[model samples]
Target: MKRYLQYGFTTFADHYGSSEILYGQFRKGLLASAMPTTPRPIGATKWCVFRSPPTPYSRKYVEEAVRERMSRTLSDGIDILQFHWQDYDDPRYMDVIQHLLDIKRDGKLRIDELGLVNFDSRRVDEICRTFGSGALVTNQVQFSLVDTRPLYGMASVCAKHQIKLVTYGTLCGGFLADKWLNKPQPDPYFDSLTPSQRKYLDVILGAWGGWELFQTLLSVLRAIGDRHNGLSISNVAVRWVLDHQFVAAVIVGARLGVAEHKDDNAHVFGLRLSQQDRVDVASVLADRTDKI
Candidate 1:
């Protein structure tokens, strides 16, 4: 499932690389032609496909990407293919499902080889019923120590249906790490980063109770890190999400050639956040509202 979904990103990247996809064309035009065009989302910006500067990814591109990925997976001796959609109603979605079923009947694709992503908890049963039992594999969503709303309903639904979860934004873009512990409030326009990056960082600070409160939260995590054999704050953040049941994996972003942090990221599985560490984190995070 992850492989198919991850491949989708590269598919979009390839399209963008060639300026064939709608958003890719739009972005290329915006950059090269210097025309004042309306911004479109290239893909899922939040958790799935984050397009810098934002652009619309049309249905045609998604369908093409899925087809190519599915074909590649079948050729690789992998029977399962996890299909993901930001919305449930795209015509290509039905077409893809029907195509897969047709192929499965003809011994091309297997029935147990399909899955979905981004559906709400309320729709899980419907998904399972429509797709068949064990067909819908995952409901990837934004779940983290800072955001517990998924636990209220989605987690239970997943548990009931025996579906797995692939969580993103667990570290909230490295904001949970010690880098922001006592750092001053970020200048919205001072940094050269993307608008989306600045926006999420601000939200993380605000939700963690601003800079002062964030310092306190960092101290607690640091203490926990010491007890866990000197695990870093990032290790604790990732572990906190992974420690929860139903989380099959936590998607952590990797900046290529940044060898300094790779060793630290690897330590997440080595140390566990103690019960007291969780309590302290909750205490700091209590009553703080989300900024997303």
Candidate 2:
């Protein structure tokens, strides 16, 4: 793993509200530990869009932000810059994106590609139209078996623009795993769920047709998993998302040394769902109308 780190394939996303200095130090320490004899990969780091609000509209501010980002992670080799924004109505995001493009054009930064995070379908189409199809490469969004809203509009725009969808939440905050399957509905007060659990639980209850429907979905996934060499529910869930044509990749959250699914996750690559499996899963999801 350390040797792999030296090859520069390790990618890290900037956390909101965190200082760049701290992030740089952490990245540097990891890279320094890697063996120098290893062959270097094409790029090392992927900087996400900075969310500082004071000057979102200012080109100068945007440039400075990019400069700061490059200064911090350039040593690690940044491959792509992914942007995140809250309000789609704000025209300033376009300005910021244009400025980043201009910076890339100027050869001031070594960024290889640019993309968006959590931008809606409409906004993604607008950005692609304004900037041209190749300007952006992907739109990262919360996509999963339960939240298939992206299938409706985002998929078409992405297909048209040739932008792939990098999906997160495919496991629904670990709720889709076998540990929760057939288990009694958790009491929010008595059960100690992680922050992700609380967040996605709300989505499950409010938008995903509540506990009963979720159980049905889980049962369907379990049956599919059992047929495919007893793959875990999470593996089946992720495999289902990967089966989609629009999905470029799935971002599975890790807790480092605390808990790891390295082996179970590896099963996803080997498992293949049959057409009957797809039909069974789709049959369960077809009844739901809520969009996440």
Candidate 3:
């Protein structure tokens, strides 16, 4: 399970201090060296193992791609190669899965497990069911306090298939923290926002009961953090998600070379949410939020 790895840029120095598990949208050779291999991912980017099945849908394409990435990545093998199907309309994803599994069975590709990225509940059900359970073990998705859609459906689907969710955006692009607490709502049109801040800002304004209510949620989180030996708003937010049984891990965002949160985030490791903490967080959600 990968969690607390918030590095936007990766460096040996930054990587050394970051979470043991490495992840993200790859930048070619950045992750090719100096790492303890766990279940590292490859699907989000096109260069992953299976460099992407090219046109013609041939197994050789997949085989060669897998070998190419494996050669570039860990010499022994990739612990788990995660796959992302960009176009469900294209049935070739099945061919990719088949090729990867077939290569693994042949003991050449050396992928121990196959996970997924951003697949919906229905498709996850279908993939596991069609591929005969255990085909995929984890599905990465945008899940957090602001976006709880997974709880209604993804949670049950994962339970049925015995799959766990690898969650990103758990901190709502760093919005659910003490820094944003009681701050005036920034003008979306005029203000500068990072890609993540912009995305979650929309969620906060349109769906999560707007800026005013979001402030309320942040205040509650701050209070909860104070209760927990003065933990930061971030620690409380991350803990809330970790408290859920279905989530295998929550990925927090970070700026590798520019900034590091290893010390700050370390607090979340053993943090446990009390019943009252849950209730306080829930109260904010109950009173002010769309069904999302």
Question: RMSD for each model, in Å, please?
Answer: 11.0, 3.3, 5.8
Cα lDDT tens digits, model 2, 64-157, are 6666666765353356678887765566788888987987788766567888888998899999999999999988888999889898999899
Instruction: Please provide, for model 3 over 97-132, each residue's C-alpha lDDT reduced to its tens digit, 9 standing for 90 to 100.
Output: 778788777886577767787788988898888877
Candidate 1 lDDT by residue in tens digits, 1-292: 1122223322122122222334333444444654344332222111123232133445454445445543432222223344555555443445455555555456543333444456677666666566665655666677776666677787787777788776767777667777777777677778655454575666656664466666677788888888888788888988888887888777675443452365677677567666788888778767465522
Instruction: List the candidates ranked by lDDT, beginning with the highest.
Output: 2, 3, 1
Ranking of candidates on TM-score, top first: 2, 3, 1
Question: What value does the lDDT take at residue 255 in candidate 2?
Answer: 62
Cα deviation at 194, candidate 3, in Å, is 0.9
Backbone clashes, each candidate: 6, 0, 1
TM-scores of all models? Answer: 0.68, 0.86, 0.81
